[model samples]
Target: MRVAISRCLLGDNCRYNGKTKPNAAVIRSAKNVEVVPVCPESAGKLPIPRPAAEQRDGGVYMSDGTDVTRQFQAGACKEFDRVKKSGAPLAILKAKSPSCGSDLIYDGTYSGTLTAGDGVFTRLLKQEGITVATETMVEEMHPSVEHPVAIVLGTGLGSITDLVHVVRRIDYHDIEGFPDNAQPIEGHRFEAAIGALDGVPVIVYPGRIHLYRGYSAAEVTSLVRHAFRLGCRDIIFAGATGAIPGKVEKGLGILTDQINLTGRNPLAEWEGLRDVESPFVDMNDLYSPYMSSIARGVAKDQNITIGAGVFAGVLGPSFETRAEVSALRQLGVSYVGMSTVNEVIMAHALGMHVLGLTLAANYSGGCDVDHQSVLATAKRYEDDFQRWVRGIVHLL
Candidate 1:
C-alpha cells in the first residue's frame, strides 16, 4: 500500500525546532510499503529553527502575534497536490501539529492546550477523499494481513451471516470454552461459519453469550480467543444498541470508543491462557481508528448515513432505567448496549484489530423497549448494514 506520511515521523528534522519526532511504530509499519515523505512547513520555505506557530482565530500565527496563515496554506496546498498525484489512499500525519494534525491540535495560545480539529494539510487531504491517520493509529493499520477477519454478531444482527459464502461450520458446543449446555438466546444463533464475504476471508460468529446471561468474562469472550487461535488478526463487533435521546438517531452507527460499565475484565478472568505476556493492556485505540476510518469512507461511498459515537456497555438482560439513561447521556455516551465490551477488551489483549459497529434499535429508557421490538427495529436496517459490512470487508 502506498501511504503519504509526515517527514518528521520518519526521522526528518523538518520541524521549526530543527528536530525530528521519530516514531518507532510508524517506522516499523512503513517497512516494504511505498512511503511518500512530506513536510508542509519546510515546503512553505519556512527555515529550520523558524518561529514556532499555532493555529488560532481561524489562522496560523507565531507566538509574538505575527500571522503566518498564508505560508501554512501554501505549504499545505503544495503537499496536498504532491500526495494526490502519488495516488496514495492514506496519510499518516503528526498529531497535534499546526499543519499535520488529523484529530486534535494546539488551541493556539501556546499554552499546550489541545482542541478537536484537523490541521491544514489534513484538511486538504480529507477534502480530496484521502484517509488521514496519525502516528498513534499506525499500529492498527497493519500494512498487510494474511489472516481472515472475524465478525462477531450480537442480538438480532445475525442476518449478516446470510451474505457469507460458507466454507465450513462449527457448533458452539464443540468450541473450547463455549458452554456445552448453553442454549441460544432469543435473536441469537449457536454456530460459527468459516466463509468469504464479498471475496474477503472471514470467520463469522452469529451470536454471543452475554454477561447478564450468567456467563463469566472469559466465557463471554471465548469467541475472541477462538478467532485469534484460528489465525484471525482483525475482528468486527456488531450489535444492537439503544440510542440515547437526541444524542444519536435510531439507525446504524460506528463505535469510536467504549465505556465498560459491566465492571469485568477478560484478562483478569481468563486464567487458562498462558500466552499473555502481561495483563496490563493499554486500552487506548482499542476500537481501531484506522479501521473506523475505512468504515466511514465506505459509508460515504455507499451513501449510508452512519453516525459515530461512544458506546456504554452495561451488564444487562434488562433495559436501562430512566435515571441510568440520564447518567449515561451526561457521561457523553451516544449508545448503550449489553455486549461488545468484554469481547473488545479480550480482542485488544490478544493483539487483534477491532472495529465496533452498532444498530440503534431503540431509544434508551423507552417504555416499550423489549427484545422483540429491538429485533424488529434491527430488521429495518438489515439491508444497509449488510451493504456497509460488505463494503468494509472489500476495502480490507
Candidate 2:
C-alpha cells in the first residue's frame, strides 16, 4: 500500500511558521506501508517556510487576507497529481488544517471552531478518488471485522404489483413522489442510504444521481464526499440498465467490470480554485476482485445467473429504440443506463473499492420492449433481487 501522507504530520518543519504536528499513526503506518510525504502548500510552489492561511468569504487565503487562495489551490493540485503518479492506494491528511482537513476545516473565523468545510486539498483529493482518512478515523477503523452489509433500494424497481404476501407496505403516494419524480433525500441522499446500512456495518450506495438532472459539478462530487465521511473505504453500486440488442446477454444481471462514460469528467477543471492536482482518478483495477469473488459465490448459492461485462452510460429518461441499441452495441455497451457511471467513477477516483452490478430489466426496444412489461419484469424479480442482495451484503 503506497500511501500519500501530509508533510506537516511527518514532522517536517513546513508549517507557515516552521512548526510540525508529528502524527504518531503516520509513523506507525510508515513501518508497514510505503509512506509518501506531501505538503500541498509546498507542492503548489509555496516556499517550505510560508505564511499561515485561512478560508474567507468564498476562498482560502492568507491570514491578512492578501488572497493567496490561488497559490494554495495550485499547490494542492500539484501534490495530488504527484500522488496519482506514485499509484498510492490511500492518503492520510491532517484534520482541520487549511491544507488537508478531510472535512470540518476551520472556517477562517480564527475562533478555534470547525465548520462543514473541506480543506482545499481535501476536496480536490476526493474528486480524484484517493482514499482520504483523517487521524481520528484511522484509529477507529484500525480493527477489521466482518459485519452485515446493508443494501438500500432506491427508485426504478418493480412496483408493489403483487401485494399478496406483503404484510408491511410504505405508501409511496403520500411520500412526495412515489413512482416517478422521487428524489430520495436530495443533498442528504447518501446519508439517508448510509443510515439504512448503519447498524449493518458494511455501507453500500446502490444507485445515485444521474448527471443529466442539470446538477452542478460540486453537487455530484458530494456523493463521494459524504461516503468518505461515513467511514466507507469501499462502495458497491447495483444499477438498473437497458440491455442493448444482439449483445449476447440481455435482461439479465450484468456485473460490469468497466464503464465508458463520454460526457464531462468531474475533475477536468479547477483554475486554481481548490487545492489538489489533476482530477484524473485512476480507472485501472476499479473493480474489487475480492468483492467479485463474493458476488459470484452468492450467485452460486442463490442459483441466480449473472453476466460480467461493460456498462455504457448515456443521458436518459427517453428509452432507446432499435437503432440506438445497435449503435450502443458497436460502442461496446452490453448494458446502457443513465446512472451509476459517475458514482462509480467518483468512488474509484477516491481510492474506494468499487464494484458495479446492473440489474437489466429489459432489452432496449429492438422489437419487443414495453414500459408496462419492463415494470412487471422488475417487479417479478424483486424478491429474487432482494435475496441475492442480502447474500452479497453479508459477504461484504
Candidate 3:
C-alpha cells in the first residue's frame, strides 16, 4: 500500500525555519511500502526561512501579522492533488503545523496556545476521503492485531471484567464531558479496562449511560467512541434484553439488525465529528457478518445454541406493556431492550466493526422482571459468555 507522509517526517528540510522533523519509525515503514512525501508549505511557494504560521480562524497567518491564508491554501491544494494522484490510502502527518497538522494546531494568536483544528492539507485530504492521522495515531489505525475486538459489558454483565488481564485503566472521570452526577445504578461500573483477553489486546467498558437517565445520545454512547479512540476496531455488546416469545429463546443471541424505536440518534446531536466523511453513514451490514460468523462458530465449539434476531431498542426505565410487546412482535422484533442500539449506531458511524451478543433475561410480555432477574440470568451464562468472547477476540 502507498502511504502519504509529511515531507519533514521523511527528513526533508521543508519547515518554515528550514528544519526537518524526521521520524525513524515512519522512515522504517517506508522500506516496505511506497511513501509519497508531501510539503504543503513548500508547495505553496512560502520562503524556506518564512515566518512561522499557525491556524487561526481557519486560515494561516505569520507572526508579523501577515495573513498568508491564500498561500497556505494554494500549497494545500497543490499538495492535495499530488497526494491524491499517488493513490495513497493512508497519510501520517505532522502534529501541529498549519499546513500538515492532522488534529491540533496553534490558535493563530502566536501565543503558543493549542486548539483542535485540522491543517490545510490534512483537511483537504480528509475531505477527499483519505484516512489522515498524526504520527501519534498511526499505531491505532494499524495495530499489530488489526481490528482487536472490544467488549462493551451491559448492566449485570460487568462481571466479564474479571476475564481481562488488565494492562491499563482509565477512569470515566478522566474523560471530558462525562457526567459526574449521573445516578449510579447497582451493577454499573464507571472505569475503563484495557488489557489482553486470551492474549489479545481488548478494551472493556463495564458501565454505560442511558437516555432514560437524561443523558443525550452522545453521553449514552461515549464509551463506544472512547473505545474507538483507544484503538479498538471491533465492538461486542453483551447486554440483558427481553426475549420476544416464539422467536429467539430465553438465553444468548447474536444480533442481525436493530429497530431504533428509541427515537433518538447519537450522530444527530454530535457536532464536529471530523473523522467521518459524512453523518449519513451506511448501516447495510450494520452488524458485522464476519464477526457474527466467528461468534457463531465459537458457540458451536462450546455446544452452546445461539439464536440470531432483530433487536428492538426503546427509551425506558419501565418494562414494555403487553400491548407494546405485541406491537413489537408484529414489527418482527426478536429482542427488546433499553440500551445497546444507540451505542451500536455510534460505533457504526465511526466505521468500527460491530457484534451484538444479547442475553435474554426474560420474556418481554408479562415476565415483570426486575433488575435482579437480569443479574441472575447473566450469572447463569457467565462461563459461556466468557468463552464466546475469548474465542471471538482470538479470531480477531
**Best candidate, lDDT-wise?**
1
- RMSD for all candidates, in order, please: 7.9, 13.5, 12.1
Per-model clash counts, in order, read 0, 9, 0
TM-score result, candidate 3: 0.63
Q: Which is superior by TM-score, 1 or 3?
A: 1
| Model 3 Cα shift for residue 22 (angstroms) | 33
Candidate 1 lDDT over residue span 179-279, tens digit each: 87789988899999988887778889999998887889989898889998998888999999999997998889999999999989888888755666655
> Model 1: runs farther than 4 Å from truth?
1-77, 80-146, 272-277
Model 2 bad stretches (over 4 Å): 1-154, 157-199, 203-207, 269-273, 367-373
Q: Given candidate 1, what's the lDDT at residue 194? A: 89
Clashing residue pairs, backbone N/CA/C < 3 A, model 1:
none
Error of 3 at 314 (Å): 0.2
Q: How close is every model to the real structure, measured as TM-score?
A: 0.72, 0.51, 0.63
lDDT scores in order: 0.87, 0.61, 0.80
Please tell me which model should have the higher TM-score, number 2 or number 3: 3
> How well is each residue in 43-100 modelled by candidate 3, as lDDT tens digits?
8899989888887766678998899999999989998998889876667788888887
RMSD of 1: 7.9
Model 2 C-alpha RMSD vs. true structure (Å) is: 13.5
For lDDT, candidate 1 versus 3, the one ahead is: 1
Candidate 3 pairs with clashing backbones = none
